[model samples]
Target: MDKNIIVSWMEAGMIQVPNLLMQKYKQIGLDEKELTLLLQILSFIETGNEFPTPEQLAERMTISSGECSGVLRKLVQMQFLSIEEGVSEDGIRFEKYSMSPLWIRLADELKFEKKQSDLKLTLLEEHDLYSLFEQEFGRPLSPMECENLAMWLDEDGQDPVIIKAALREAVLAGKLSFRYIDRILFNWKKNGVKTLEQARMQGIQFRQKTKQPTQPTTGTSSKTIPFYNWLEP
Candidate 1:
């Protein structure tokens, strides 16, 4: 409502608090008072005051200067904050509060959380793939079979969908064995069949070249099997 007051506010500028810090302060073990104090220090630093005294910071916060001092010490001890000594052009030593450590810790926390989430997703995918294999075979996979599956995923970097397609090809060809599935995957990879559509097209082309028409099954439900013999030359 007041133009002069708005102008003054605009001229005073503002301090930037990281969105990550607001979202993850509690996760990083910072309480309300501690967070407020850190914000005060950030404000001072933004205004060219790199090293504000505890009394100056406390004046803008709800806590007393003594409490501010204690919190600052605690932050330093936790490696979330640090005081670094620097020399000015006049060769005078001065101490400044550095928030680099806090930023580093927050970055590390984010990385750790992402790594954990990826690990969980990978484990879930692995479980589902194993279940699919076991259901298709109608038996629990042996330890060696499980290891091979893991190798295909982790070592060979095989796409899970591609592996599923290979398995389906093996089943349709009436050759449901790991060795056969492995050969199918190998041939698909060698021929640059990365996607399910590409693999299907390749199978169709191979069948057409050999003049093998899919035989229709007579039952309540009819099924067409597109079988490709990967082991054949």
Candidate 2:
């Protein structure tokens, strides 16, 4: 390793914590502890001769030994590894772990996900999604309402498909009001408005037919002046 490069990286205040880890935690879907665990594992693999044992992983994560074993087993179950049960130097062991080629692929996938979230999150904040609500409604929303709006836009939030169906229903029903979207959402969910076609079909239809004046009402007598009367005068 270049000493100067190493020193420079160390000097980066916190760059040593791995950009990937930072990015992972920054995503709304991932929490700090999960990110920390993944970072520790990745760092271990990068530095150690092979995949670290559960005990070693536990120590690094500052978790209990049993929890470490369980977590490692879960990783194996998650297909991040393909390990077989075996005994370690401690006589009996759960399993010995090895890296699957999938880790790199997963890192790439996770990084892509992280970047996409960053874009969406920044847009939501910079554009002020609360403003979207207020602008659309032509009124100021309550703080709680704004928080609800944020939840909808969150990366791990509710399905947009469901949320949109609710809006559609509210618009379709004469009872339709942005204020009533929450209540109408239940109806939309029950009605299963999966697409625009379904929603349009569900909307109210109006028909207009022009009616001619009812034949001047038969009870009324019609008065007319003869053309010859004017000549006599």
Candidate 3:
């Protein structure tokens, strides 16, 4: 072992482990004895001691050598630590433990946490979408309306932003019905408008294309425009 390397590590700050590791200790399948063993191993590594015997480990704790050996064996079988036989500086064959498997387990735990967090965020956004609809409509949502909204989120996998944009378009068109909003969402989906920006840009393009110079009408009586004509297939 290099004395310079040990001196450099001492010059560095305190050894810090992630708080999540302690928080999720039980979730990672660590019993009290196993956790204690792991901490002891970590301490041994920190002090530049590679291999501590079961007797040496047991003496530091309240457990016996046999109990310590049993726990260590269990940890090895669970792949939390791997034992490898190596020659020490004293020319004696000793067992060396590697903590790579524990790191791998922590990595898996972090991935699971991220996936769960993402799922929670998506559900929150879906709930927000429902609330937005109720606020805009100025009434409690009907059961059928709630069902349709669930289908749009769960079955159709429509984004909340796209649905909100479609609702705004329906409001602009003076046709504030669920069917009209659904049709708008359908059309936007068909046109590959997956985001609010894409829908807004598409709306701008459509308005530009339809905008024309107003012509003077000859008849004195105004024509009654059909409201349900927009719903025609």
Candidate 4:
């Protein structure tokens, strides 16, 4: 409706509240009242009032000036807010509120959460890789085998998908040994075969180059067995 109200609202402007602050306020130990107070302080700062009095802040809040003062003290004590003193251009001293500490704390919290999420995903991938290996090998891995698998993951930094592709290559060649799989993985790594599709294409090219017309040995069929020899250059 009203044109004058709309103009007044437009002139009043808006305050910016970060999504992260809204989502993580409780986790960071801020209650609803404290969060509202922080937003009010931010709104005042945006409107050219960096240091609003408790009574002024209370005018737009449900809390009284006394409660507002107590919350402001708590915020300062918790390092979420700071008041810095400065001399004006007229040589008069003044105090202004700073929200830098709150922002820094929120940034640290986000970083810590991301690190935890990454760690969980890595652990899950490692577990799935181990299970796949045991299923293919038809037995639980020995301590030495487990260590080698971990080395391939943690030290060599091999992708779990590429490792699985290597295992499949060994199985297809009818040479289902860990040594053969390791050799395939090593060759694939040396040739920069980092994905399952790349490994398959490389295998096809190697077999084509090495294809030969074979004379079957005695008691063997004439059909040639197709296998890429990873051990050979």
lDDT of each: 0.88, 0.54, 0.81, 0.89
Candidate with maximal lDDT: 4
lDDT of 2 by residue, 123-228 (tens): 7663554454466567888778766655654742434545555455444443435456655444434576565565445443110111212244578854433211
Candidate number that wins on lDDT, 1 or 2: 1
Report backbone clashes per prediction: 0, 0, 0, 0
Clashing pairs in 3: none
Q: How would you encode candidate 4's per-residue C-alpha lDDT over 17-118 as one tens digit per residue?
A: 999999999888899999999999999999999999999999999999999999999999999999999788999999999999899889989999999998
Candidate 3 lDDT tens digits, 1-233 = 89999999877535456676688778889987898887787767666667777898898899998999999999999988888788868998977788778878888988998999999998898888889888989898999999999899889989887888887877777887899899887878788988788999987776665464345478654444433323555
- Model 3 weakest lDDT span, ten residues long: 221-230
| Candidate 2 segments exceeding 4 Å error | 1-129, 147-158, 161-165, 168-179, 194-201, 204-233
Candidate 2 scores a C-alpha RMSD against the true structure in Å of 16.3
In model 1, pairs of residues that clash are none
Q: Arrange candidates by lDDT, highest first: which order?
A: 4, 1, 3, 2
Q: How accurate is candidate 2 locally (lDDT)?
A: 0.54
Q: Which is superior by lDDT, 2 or 4?
A: 4
Q: Where does candidate 1 stray beyond 4 Å? A: 87-92, 154-159, 187-228
Backbone clashes in candidate 4 total 0
